[model samples]
Target: MTRCRLCGSQATASVVDLGATPPCESFLAAGQLDRPEPTYPLHLRVCTDCWLAQIPPLITPEETFTEYAYFSSFSTSWVEHARAFVADAVERAGLGPEAFVVEVASNDGYLLKHVVDRGIRCLGVEPSVNVGAAARDAGVPTLTAFLSPETGSAVRAEHGPADLVVANNVYAHIPDVVGFTRGLRSLVADDGWVSIEVQHLLTLIEENQYDTIYHEHFQYYTVASAIRALASGGLTLVDVELLPTHGGSVRLWARPDGVAGEPSRRVADVLAREKAAGLQELSGYTEFSARVAKVRRDLLRFLVEAAERGETVVGYGAPGKGNTLLNHCGIRPDLLPYTVDRNPYKHGRYTPGTRIPILPPERIAADRPDYVLVLPWNLRAELAEQLSYVHDWGGRLVFPIPELSIVEGTS
Candidate 1:
């Protein structure tokens, strides 16, 4: 019985299996091209008691992030998002040269760099070695280790309490969620704020974003579920903001117990909207598997049709979500000639399981393929603009999940 990691709820309610898939970030080395790719069962289940959507236990964080490949600084849109987030938070929180800020899972210090530029003391707790080194090189001091109650306590003892603790897109990745959140109680100052950004479970189900499922992403969160989990760890939600990033995410501002942190009206409003959308009910889980299956079917049909017509199809953005979508749809080199990535680490590699080569974006211009499939559909607009040069060849871009559509004015 795989119990709920946060609430210890042992009721294994509804399981939606997406069958064997490879580690989303294990984009293969170039030499291993011909070798058979390994995959593991990709199944998701909902905790009936807590209403948390989670994947069954399989891989460990060490297996996922030790030598992580995905670098956040590579994406222009993501960097811009990070910069804007830092600017707003610093201003909103009155964090200036005197404040101390900490960011958990601060991959390559993408957001912290902006905070550091303001001369405020900032620290990063990152588990991945390679990415941590990159951040250090960028002059962002980072602790190359996982965040836990012990680490948080030690840090608090040494550096004193933080004014702002940010965990962007990381609340969903933690396994020892309760312990981690408990740790927050030690590090966050009495008047400090801890902001967590997670992909909303309500949005995931309503929008059919099953592609977000991957081993690294252990939990999908909702405002109600998050408040419940945080309350258990002695934190209270103060405010909530819905963000447009990652197909729709929520930023929950919290503080330690008895700190006068009341859950905002927006929090209640969002939870009400979530309940109205049926996230608290079992019916929401019923159609997700079928919707995921439909995604696989529709995508395969489109890829095979494109292949049959002798129209070459390629993929853009070798993101973790793209890996899930590709592996689930069984896309191979034959279907997607290759995928392009801006990250140099993934440039010469092959996507795990799918074995589709990940080359530089130059491949898109050189090949002049008929269609370029935008895998990270959330960044479709940015990528489309970047590849507008494809218009010269009369080629068009294709976005599969959410909906299948081709950009106009090109082949």
Candidate 2:
């Protein structure tokens, strides 16, 4: 952590130091809960040279993603988002029956399934054994391995260079930013495109989305830093799109250095926005730590007062971001006795650091708690509707990030 992971510079600045917490997705089994749980320093620093905000690479992707607990298909909105992205990408790239598409870190073929439906040749590079099996079961061709330079070249040799390589929500997950970008460059044809969707540091600061910072997400990006990261891999930035996923994300389109045409005007427009926000300098980050502290205080106050009133409060999702929120706020089972998730794999397990029990979604209805805390507030629209039944018993939903607020029902 002394040196920047993206740039080899010793001059770095502290952004936020979310105290030690276990790996966000490391849900513990009942037997293991009795044993000691390991925690690491969950601190994020920015490279003064490159402006790339990152955390220490304390955990490897293999450790967390091999038997991954998350399944992209579980979220209805996410699945539809993937479907729409596939359709738009195909049309924009002039993809045909003969065109080959590949998606790195493809979870359970959520995005590639749409490509399969269109009869386009597609492959999924997923590291998780269990989720990769699910992708295969769903008839999406998959290779079980992490994305590295060697892995990318091996795929190219076996199936030929892809026309389009899609990577979503995984660009920031790798510690070796330069190596991962090179691997991405190795996956596509000389003239093919690589589209990546990663959380934008701009909105993360503007909206107080510090909960998204965790060990798995090693680095966060701005358009300026992203352009530099792409150049390190021998790729040229072509276009950019502002997206609503993961609080706020940027969809970057790149191609081989020479083949990539002049940069799009949107790229300059977004860069202008980032510059206006002061993200390229130290001024943008000075107040972020203060805002993050306020978020922790406001949520803790609500949970404590509710407990004092003898009112019951439970959590709604066991996402990685939720784990960060819970651990950073020092919340324990005494305040949030249990949380429910749609994924059955975590049904009987416990959250990594907080030790809060994870139950099935139906448990909320069965117990009818006074309040249901929605941890994955990024999906406010979707979960608000899914949990509309809480209104039946006068149970309200609470969102902790951006500000603690209560909602009667669907937004």
Candidate 3:
């Protein structure tokens, strides 16, 4: 009887069970393949009281993130996203030289670099030592520690309250949603604002993005549930924007409770949309398990047929979501052969469970396989453009999620 992390209620109902899986980020070395790998049950539950979809934090943060392999700077599109965000945020907030900014889970200082370039004071809070070292090397001041109430207070005492606190794609990573939101409230000045980006639960269900579920991500928040979680820490939502990144995400702008100014119409509109989508009720979640199971069967059938036809297949991008898809479908090196990634950290490693070798993107052109499975289906357009050369040799791209489809000629 696990209690809901947000509302502390026992009315949590099962949403979907993904069986036992290893941490999605746990890539393996060749030498370690023979050793036993640990796995945990990957089950998601929806809180009837608050409607927060979440999984229990069976794995500790230290075990999953202390020495992370994923670095934000490795992806060109992601870096561009960060730059655009910094440019817009600075201008929108009327920021100047004296303004202070802090970014939580600031991996490799990808976004903070843009702020520092503008001659503003900024600090990065990152938990991974490897990524933090890279951030320091890039001339970004960073604190290699997890953010909590105590750490937030210490940061405030040393550097004063931040004018802007940016938490992008990190709201779902925290195990203690209440304490984490409180820490966020403590770091911002009374008049300052906090901006949070999280993948919307409505999009996840509608788009059939079950691959995003893993041990590292604890919660999937709807606009209504997100408002409740933040309100517990005395924060109030003032604005919200929908972003196309990571399937579909929502960027929320919040201020301390009792602050002047009414919430924008966008906030009310999004909440209404969520309610209409049935995110506020349990019936909406009951059918998801069947959808997920259908995806697994459909994908496996495609891969097996491709193999029977004597067509060579490989994977593109070694993202965490790809790991979940591969492991859930019981794909192995024989089916996928190997995958390619732009990140050097994962280049020489193998994916967990499936143990498919990961190589550099250049190998795709050299091998010229018949079919390339675009594992990170959310970035299909970017990947299609980058790998357009494959079409020269009659190679087509395949997307497994949201139904299997063959994409031709970069479209």
Candidate topping TM-score: 2
lDDT tens per residue, model 2, 1-411 = 888877799988999899999999999999997899999999888888999999989999989999999999999999999999998899878899999999999999999999999999999999999999999999999999989899999999999999999999999989889998999989999989999999999999999999999999999999999999999999998999999998899999999998998999999999999999998889999899999999999999999999999999999999999999999999999999999999999999999989999999999999999999999999998998999999999999999878998998566
- Give the root-mean-square deviation of each candidate in angstroms: 1.6, 0.8, 1.0
Q: Ranking by lDDT, best first?
A: 2, 3, 1
Best by lDDT: 2
Q: Give candidate 1's TM-score.
A: 0.96
**Model 1 stretches astray by more than 4 angstroms:** 33-37
**lDDT score, candidate 3, position 72:** 92
Off by over 4 Å in 3: none
lDDT of each: 0.85, 0.94, 0.91
Q: lDDT (0-100) at residue 272 of candidate 3?
A: 94
What are the per-residue Cα lDDT tens digits for candidate 1 across 88-137? 89887888788999999999988999988889998999999999999999
Cα error of candidate 1 at position 169, Å: 1.0
User: lDDT by residue for model 3 over 1-411, one digit each (tens)?
Assistant: 378888899998898888888999999998989999998888988999999999989998899889999999877888999999999899877889999999999999999999999999999999999999999999999999999988899999999999999999999999999899999998999998899999999989988899999888999999899999999888999999999888999999999997837989999999999988888887788788899999999888888998999999999999999998998899998889999999999988999988999999999999999999999898877888888998999999999878788888879
Q: What's the true lDDT of residue 169 in model 2?
A: 94
